[model samples]
Target: MRQHGLLTLGAGLCAAAALGLAAPHPALAAPDSCSYTSPTHQPTLTHGDTGAAVKQAQCLSNMWGGEPPKLPLDGVFDSVMLKKIKWIQGCHGLPQNGVIKDRTWQVLYHPALDCYDPYPV
Candidate 1:
């Protein structure tokens, strides 16, 4: 058996067709999987670092998905993460030192849609 009278909607009928029944709301956008922290609070992260900050960097780095593959989000800055960081840095014309500092943070947060430099094999 099933209930029928329990189907109550919005108090103001807000759940109209505009809510995707007929068309998608133009202003709505789903958030991505990554989003580890506020951009302003990014710490100076380097290899061997671990914790939320490292996780943040890893998450953001995954946003730049390319040749190397997405990181594990384990918060450990291993050699693989280092190479990816260097590639991202190089793409932004920053020094490819494999250090996730201020400028690197900027790129990680706002990565270019396309990178001219190919990911190294």
Candidate 2:
């Protein structure tokens, strides 16, 4: 009788542990609903216009809540601001190229990139 009880208890604990490992915690689970959108269009990166540079600068400025480094929007790519952009990319699981790619733009524009709702009903 004692052995049978111990066996049952051990099996129950093992099952509980398996379930815990298989199931995601509430915090880790995806939200039931979210509102987000991707960038409709890419920034125009003209040879001398440097749209990517301008967008990156704007994003950094918005993130830091201040004026960004006065870098030329001519494809020069500011090293300092590039580093900050890379950091932002890293945090958001982006390519970290320091250049504003489409994915980066999407994240920059949308508040809920991870939980975007293409067509909210």
Candidate 3:
């Protein structure tokens, strides 16, 4: 798994300033309904799990843009989904085990656009 370095605070601020975008304030980033509605009590999904929950996870992952591009919203948790989930987990500093736990679901619904960490697939 190749890990990429996170952007420094100064660099992030500079980029936001240069782009004329407001730097996101930690306190102002509110949790939205998307996170609330996403799957919470479903069993941990891994390779070969198929159903609505898997499809929902895939759909939410599209909101989380990153390497490997957007995935097809199929109702199967295959290898591709596993790789993407692991990547997202690593990006959010969670255990990169490809398991769709509660925290993983939260990150899927609300993602950072500038995830510097490279997902080691």
Candidate 4:
């Protein structure tokens, strides 16, 4: 299996070189439901933050559903959002800190299909 993977990787690299490319570009997260600025450009959000970005984060987090209860989408980062964020971080194997940093944002945009951790109370 390792040898096959290595061969595949080598073939991919050779193909990329032949095509005059560095490597394959990864797929970007799907279009989000919110109309706010693209999530990639939004600033980090944490406790006490509020605005379109917060609304955007809330909306994305809601997609996780039972991983954490859905948020209000009210553009306010309150306790509920904090708790939900922490659970989401845990599900993604990220720091359990409830801050919406870059990695957190990425996970929010692209959550796992199914989290292995049991839902938080």
Candidate 5:
């Protein structure tokens, strides 16, 4: 009787192992959906006057999903825009200072750095 019980337990263990091997874990499965992609590609701001900064802001706005929150892109560093950019930086897991630092630019423009595909259209 004991021998029969041992055999049954071994068979159950084998079946469980087989089932585990046959199916993928739920965590490894793909997500149900994702968001739309952005349009613009890597954008370089001229950085000398307000116009350049504005242009950068526009490009950033497009990348984000709307117009940039009115930042002076020509290197003037508008306070409002700076706060907004800081928010963006926070989202991107960077320093939140509202300044367009080089690291922030890398995350914003060159997402992949080597061959980034600037979000979606």
Candidate 6:
């Protein structure tokens, strides 16, 4: 009976290992849905918003390059993101306000850093 119980326990452990019960599977891990691809429509993103779109905006903002380090890929529009947006807007000769409007999206997607005078730092 003791030997039979040991065999059963070993089998159960092996099954658990095979089933990946010991650690999280790749599929079980959180998806990279936060990586924003492109703006379908001009969704006005303000400082208080949070979602994949915001994350996408952050990613685009990072493409500006130089000065402040790249923002995290997390989907939150906090003050740091707001500041970055404002800086980008300034660089693109848009209003200094941190609001991501239609023009802001345009500048983000197509950064014409030379067209408008660089916003004062």
Q: TM per model?
A: 0.69, 0.38, 0.63, 0.69, 0.38, 0.61
Model 5 scores a TM of 0.38
CA RMSD (A), model 5: 17.5
Candidate 4 per-residue C-alpha lDDT over 38-117 given as tens digits, one digit per residue, 9 for 90 to 100: 76675878899989889888877776644334677689999889988887788778999999989898887777754535
Between candidates 5 and 6, the lDDT winner:
6
lDDT of 1 by residue, 1-121 (tens): 1333234433222343233222111122112445566656778888999988898888777766444556788989999999889988887899999988889987776776435455656
Query: Which parts of model 3 are misplaced by more than 4 Å?
Result: 1-42
| Collision count of model 2 | 0
The model with the greater TM-score, 2 or 4, is: 4
What's the C-alpha lDDT at position 54 in model 5? 45
What lDDT, from 0 to 1, does candidate 3 have?
A: 0.66
User: How many clashing pairs does model 6 include?
Assistant: 0
lDDT of each: 0.68, 0.42, 0.66, 0.71, 0.41, 0.65
Clashing pairs in 1: none
The residue pairs in collision within model 4 are: none
lDDT string for model 5 (16-121, tens) is: 4454322111222111211122223223333332544344543443343212323333434454455555555655678666556566665554332122112211
Task: List the candidate 4 regions with Cα displacement exceeding 4 Å.
Answer: 1-31
The residue-by-residue lDDT of candidate 3 on 65-113, one tens digit each, is: 4445566766888888898888888777899899997788777667766
Residue range 1-121, candidate 2, lDDT tens digits: 9999889866764674454322111232122221121235445332224454464434332432111323233444455556545554555667766666566665544423222111111
Worst 10 residues of 6 by lDDT: 22-31
* Residue pairs with backbone atoms closer than 3 Å in model 2 (clashes): none
Q: How far off is residue 66 in model 5, in Å?
A: 7.2
* lDDT score at residue 102, model 5, on the 0-100 scale: 68
lDDT of 3 at 115: 65
